[model samples]
Every structure is written in C-alpha cells, then in structure tokens.
Target: MDLDLSSAKLTQKKKNSEGINTQILRSICVKTYRTNITKHHIDVGDARPITLPPYRIWSPKTDYITQGLVHLKEQNIIEPATGPWAAPVTLQPKRDRTMRFCIDYRRLNEVTVRYVYLLPRIEDTLDALHDAEYFSTLDLRSGFWQVELDEESKEKTAFVTHDGLFQFTVMSFGLTNAPATFQRLMNVILSGLKWRCCLVYLDDVIIVSSAFDQHLKDINDV
Candidate 1:
C-alpha cells in the first residue's frame, strides 16, 4: 500500500552510479517486509514479501490534452518541422525500461505543453541559507491530502475505475495543478521574508536563523 519514492538510489539525479540502486531498493523492500510482518502478526514461515504490480504506463489518452501549432521552435527540443502546416500526432507515453516506469508527456516537449512548471532555483535556496549556522525544516507528510478540498473541485479530482465508478480523495499530489496550488500556499506562508532569511520550497519551509524564540514566533505567525 505504500507508494514510497525513496526505493531508488539516486532519484532526480541526472546520472546514477551503478549498483547503488539495487542496494537502495533492496533496503527499502527489507524495511517494508519487516513492517508488514510485524503489523499483520505473521508467523516466521508465512511472512514473505508479496509480488508488487509492475510499474505501469498510466497515460491512457485523456480528453485534457490539446493540439496546437508551435509558431516558434528549438533545435534539440523537437524533430525539425519542415512544412508550414503540421498534422496533430497522438502523444504516446515513453517507458524507460531501466527506470521501470512510464514517463508521461514524452511525445511532446515540456516547453510546448501549455502547463507552466516553475522549478525552485537551487541558487536562491542556497542564498537563503547564507547567514545561519543551524537550520531546521518542517514538512507536512502528504501535505496536499492534508488540505481540505472544496466540494465542487473534489468531484473532478478523480480517477475512473474498472467497476465503472470514478473516485477521488480530497486533494491528491498527482493532480496536474497540485504544484501551483501548493506553491501558492507556501508563498502565502512565507511572503515577506528576505531571500537571505527564511526560505520555502513547496511544502518544505526552513528558518535560516534558528533561535528557539524566533522559531516559535515564526511557526505561530505561519
């Protein structure tokens, strides 16, 4: 039941060191194995890890994708378009066999995708940590789901089921616009702080100056 991201050795890394992933994933499986054994009160003979469903390709054509011509282009971003008029192509999910997962939105470039994703600047994050000798960060586990959803939006935030019913939880992380909503919340919480002072990256917020008194006040303010 756990959708743990830490099983991989070097997630989000451009290139992973060989053999590192196997060790890390094995360690995660061991922990999951141990936890389930203890929780279910399984006998030594009966306690064995169950087979996980293979990582799946999830982009089963949705009605959400739109087709439009890109008036401008980049060289490596897409195959060069020779003609004036371009026919719409059905986008296919790209599966990385080594990663054992499907990468959504692979047939098109991210730049052309209409959806805007703002990656937090690593330099800005580092700059925020300049002065303080100590740092403490707070993260709400499954923070998106923690927030209550409005009734109207809740219905649309759903998935279709094999049983013919579509289902949704309050507000899940995998939703397309979750990042922007989460970013808004974070910005509101730390609005006026100097870039060299307190900093926030999505659900993670940290105080650069870590005095007990100041920390308590900041938490209260947020």
Candidate 2:
C-alpha cells in the first residue's frame, strides 16, 4: 500500500475540544496501515562502482567472522556474491564481549553518489515538541536490516569474510548514503501525519499530542 495520499482528501467533518476529529484520525490510520512503503536501496546514481581489493582480517577473529557469515546467510540478510568489488570486514567487541561484524565502506563512500534530502535540525525538532502535554518515542529494532537493498546495488556492497564473499540484501550500517535513504523513506511513510502529530529522525519516531485522549489516538494513527 504505497500511502500516496496525494489524491485523497481527509477533511475533518467535526472537531472535539482539542480541535481533533476522530473520524479524520481513523482515516489517517487506515491510510497508514494500507500503504505499502518501498524498501531501501543503494543509489550511486551517476557514479560507477569502484573496484577495490579486500583487506585482510585478524587471524584470531577468523572463526568469529566465519560464524557470523553463516548466521547472516541463514537469516537471508546476505548471500554469496561473486562481484569484482570486495570490501574488508572488521570485528568490534560488544558489551557482552561478542564480536560485532562490520563492513568498512569508506572507500566505496568516496565514489558512491549521495541522496541529498535534508535532515531536520535538532533545535527545530525540539521546538515542535515544547508545548506537547504527552509524548512517546519508538525505536525500530535492527532498523537498517528492515529496509531491503536493490538487486542491482547488492554487488557494490560485497564484502570479504574468512569463509567467502557475501553481499547484504538489506540496508547495512556504514554505507555513506544510507542515512539519507532511510530519512527519505521515513518522510514518505509519515507523509500526512508528519509535523502534525509526530517527528521522525531515522529509526526514532516521536508522537506528540496536547491531551491524554488525543495522545492515545495519535499513537494508533502513527
């Protein structure tokens, strides 16, 4: 359901004390739930893929990297790739002491064309919520993985592991233009409701309302 409400008119037929109409609010919810949002994809646009040699990994972390590759493949987050471009992988230590698999895409970013949508300023976002009587924030789990990558751009994200080469089928962290792509998608999904009852910054969605009853309705609509 591509919630493209460009043609739908959601005029409020009546209003409550807070100037909110339940009928219109329900319409907003229906549109949001039915609209099928597009998945995220890498857009190098006019830039061509840059060929680079894969970097070597630490000998001690070889086993971890191999295990991580197997897990990602099992989850369908990545698949075997035989592309000319191969970036190196690194293992970062997490709070639990487990190795966090990461791909170094610095070189690729230099040549990757960027998406130019402007993110909202921090001050402006805060000002919007200053007078709100109720607020709620939702964080998207594995946010990047939620957005799928395009087949054409998957080859450009190929990375080397101890076992073999693989590429992400979903958006991965460290891509230069990923933030812009995500922000653009979020803006589109929240088209009618954005700046009216909510504020979104990447994976974080904040819903604000001036009354308790209206707050609950806003959450459901968002």
Candidate 3:
C-alpha cells in the first residue's frame, strides 16, 4: 500500500511540473499601450455631440451598472466627465444573465477619422504555422483596458448615466481605431518574433514550435 501511495505522489508531482512548464509563457509581462493623441488624432470632423436619450434600466441591472462603474472608477480606468459630449449608456445582457455596461459609440465612430492600418492576412498567418507542431494560445484579460487614452481623447468617450457623466482614461471598446491601435501595439511588442515562432491577432497570441523542447524555449523567450 505504501509503495502504491509513493508512486501516486510521484505521478502527481510530474503532472504539476508539466503543467507549470506548459504555462510558463502564459504569464507574459507586457507594458500597457498608450494612445498618442498628439501623433494620431481622432478627428470628429464637424460632428456635434451625440446625446442619445437615456435607456431605462430595471432593478438588478441598475445596481450592477452602478457597481461596475464604481469598480472602473476605483481602477482609475474612468472618471467623472463634465465635457459637452455625452453618449448614452446601455446594459447589454450577458449569457450569465448579468448586465454588461456599454456605450452607444456608433455616432462617435461615424465622425472619427478611420485608421487605415492593414491587419495581417489570415491566410498568410496560417500558412506560416504549417511547419509548427506544438502550439499554445493565450488571451489577454480585458485587453482594451490595458491601453491608456490621452487626455484630449478621453473626453470624446464621455457617456451619460443616471449617476452622472463619465469618461474613460483607458481605451474602451466601441472606438473606431481601437482594433488597429491594438494590432499596432501587438506588432510592436512581438517585433522580430512574429512570423518566426509567434502569431498575434489583437489580444490573441499563438506560440508555435516544431518540437516540444523548442516550444518551451520559444515560450520562455516570448
């Protein structure tokens, strides 16, 4: 009985070690991307402030929205806005039956100057992985929030709520050039590693390698 227990313990230890090795690159240290409003302008060309009528919220959703706003405020991701611009906030129902706080930025996107940066061709990215055998995929948590918006551009994201007006300090979803900006950041971060052993598409990162040992080394380098 003792021999069996000892063997089981060794097997569990091996499994744990393997798990740690596989997840080594999962905790990559990346710096937050900051939007250069001075260099890249979001021109709202003659488009007046779009103040959509406020949407009514029921009991639990209202509480959830308030809590969400408070959490964002605490994280310094958003702050009270006194700007003339105001977009109405809405609660998008999640699969879990919870409310997702969202701002209707359609009008804002319409007037903003579109970014023309070309995204990577899916076929090209996939073709490069033909030689790869081992693969590990990673997803950034709240990826958009990892980017900071410039002071001038923050006000442009101002939204109205029952609590008051608020603007994002970090880049929020629904912005026109957000994906392009994120892709640009990813390209910059991956630099020389891209098309070599790493494939990046916005917040998703896939590390590829032809051999297991090479995969471990590549993941560590990333």
Which candidate has the highest lDDT of all? Answer: 3
lDDT of 1 by residue, 1-222 (tens): 123335533335412332343453344344211111111010123222221222323354332221111211111112232222221223344464222111132211222223355757989788666666544455545555444444333333222212122222234434455666566666655678635456777767776664544543443344
Note the Cα lDDT for every prediction shown.
0.39, 0.75, 0.77
Q: Model 1 clash tally? A: 0
Q: Which regions in candidate 1 have their CA more than 4 angstroms from the true location? A: 1-119, 148-152, 162-164, 194-197, 210-222
Ranking of predictions according to TM-score = 3, 2, 1
Q: In candidate 3, what are the lDDT values of residues 1-222, reduced to their tens digit?
A: 001223332346443545555446334433333444322235687777776667787765688779889988988889999888888888888999877898988888988989889889999998998988877677777778878876778888989888989999888898989888888888887899998999999999999999767876777777
Instruction: Report clashes for each candidate as comma-separated counts.
Output: 0, 3, 0
Candidates in order, TM-scores: namely 0.42, 0.78, 0.83
Candidate 1's displacement at residue 91, Å, is: 23
- Shift of residue 188 alpha carbon in model 1, Å: 1.1
